[model samples]
Target chain A: MGVPDPADAELVRRARNGEKVAFEEIVRRHGPAMYRFGLRMLRDEHAVRDCVQEAFASAWEALDQYRGDAAVKTWLFSILANKVRRYLRSQARSVPTEIDEGVIHSPAQHEPERRAIAGTMMAALEEALDELPLAQRACWILYEVEGLSYRRIAQIQGMSVDAVRGAIYRARQGLERRLEAWR
Target chain B: MEMSPERDLGPPSDLLARAAGELRQLTDDGWVRAEQGVLDRVARALRSARPVRGRHEGGDFFLSSTVLCAQVGTRVDLIPGVRASSVRIVTDDVDHLDAVTLTVSVAYGQAIADVGSRARGEAAAAATAALGVQVRTDQVTVDVLVEDVFVDEARDDGGADDAGED
Candidate 1:
């Protein structure tokens, strides 16, 4: 068997002491998750990529100040939430956004019938998500899609846990209404 | 008391629940396609943020303690039965070298003293090579603290003594 990699706490300890390779390990572990998060939050391909890159850059610069009070992934999402909000503020964009369909690839593509169904459902879900307010969508994605705990999502969004639950509840209701055809 | 919407969140709909799972899969696929490009951009951005403070070697030259610690960590990790968890370089006033502390975890069944001594020697050599400022290996004060002893699960020999596994 291959040697087991060190835990995140160990990596963070090394990174705090100025190990670029350790920090790189962190990026490798969390980058994909952050990318998925960015895509869910910002439908545009370029914007999502930029958000993930900027979040990592900020994290690397602030490694010295990280106190490890929260999970590394949670801290990363907090930084990413700040970057996304800043980007949104600069653009002042409207809701009901359109995603770049070309970037989406479904794992069910091998089965043609399954692919068609998944494609339709995914399109509907994306539209439903796009219609949600940014905060509601973010709360829903972080809690539902990313499987983050409500407390962790609250930490990332700087809101009360009750507020996160409320947002998720409303988002779920809206999604249920919009995607009723698929059920 | 009024029932808050949050508290009244009924059983999640099967369609939305399935949609959430599918969204996770969809986003994961997209991320795989763009992962390399994103990481490359991140690496490029961090290049300019290297540590700035350093000990003046001489004649406008300096050696960063951060750099030294990284090197020490790399070298110490190469030793069998030991893994470096943290490496720190201490400098005195006037920016002179003070001591190097390496916290490491030793594999179960390996002699703790032996691993620590080997790590100390490697750290001193690494610091000397990294600075290259006429400092001898013997002049470097190296401390290796055994913060943990871990089971080398691959080599599970049961006759071990004093594993001190943490």
Candidate 2:
């Protein structure tokens, strides 16, 4: 259905004041976004759901620690990134194969040629993505697909903004290198 | 069906692109549901045990975790694709007609030998009886701690799986 008014600040205020209903409201308002963040990072729905839940749980506990230096979305996104990193650490040894689930509508307006090429290109891009280091993968997905800003990415990842830029740059170069052979 | 040439020939570029396209598909329901259930149980326990946090600074640390042990036991062993020689429930508490610790025994080398020491029996239980009591699975090598007896009476709510071991 529809969401309530954008009252994250108010809700967070209530939540900090110990209103679980307010907290629940915040969860309802932001759950989808948080879920999307986890989905992009984990690529495994199970792991994504887990990371989302963990991020929420940790945020609930750590909300008191929030200094209000950033927006609620940025804060929540930061927590989700930490959760994702911790998950990767625990399962670092194993190969994580993420199965994505979204309907890919072919390029609608014009550009059938690019669509054909892009479709083929998308496959190679994904393989390279899967093969890419987790840091690089997170940077690429967050930077290109999600369109998050570098500072936001850094906040999410608990790193310097410059580090985020470096990661994104490295990721872009990797994708470009992979696509070069196709060109 | 007009299959893409990439699918058939599998060039490095075609392979990579196809893999990328397929990489976004989401499939993992069972795992999510199971973990959700575990977290729910955990949340409840954390809430219930918060009251006793100050009361049991040291001695109560072990007592506060009774229900947690059960929760972990259920999660770790209940999942599919696990095998065990046995799951031994080890605890010093030995005086109960029912509601015995759901003891499980693992074969040797399953966990460190020193872990056996943490499986001591105490009059400890969760502050909120409903949450039950449990300890850290990773911290302890409890295959199971079947309760054969206890000095005090436990809740008679018939709340859980009460396997009476003679």
For this target, which candidate reaches the highest lDDT against the unseen true structure? 1
Give each model a TM-score.
Answer: 0.59, 0.45
The lowest-lDDT stretch of 10 consecutive residues in candidate 2 chain A is A101-110
DockQ of candidate model 1: 0.18
lDDT of 2 by residue, A1-183 (tens): 112234887787566545666776666666655664565455565566677777777777655434343567777777777777767656653436542221111112123322443556554554556566666677666665555666566666665655666666666567767767666
Error of 2 at A12 (Å): 0.7
Expressed as tens digits, the lDDT of each residue in B52-109 for candidate 2 is 1212334333332333333333343432222211222333343111122333333323
**Judged by DockQ, which candidate is best?**
1
Task: Give lDDT tens digits, candidate 1, residues A39-80.
Answer: 777766677777888888888766644545467898898999
* Model 2: CAPRI class: incorrect
Of the true contacts between chains A and B, what fraction does model 1 have? 0.41
What's the distance in Å from true for residue A6, model 2?
6.8
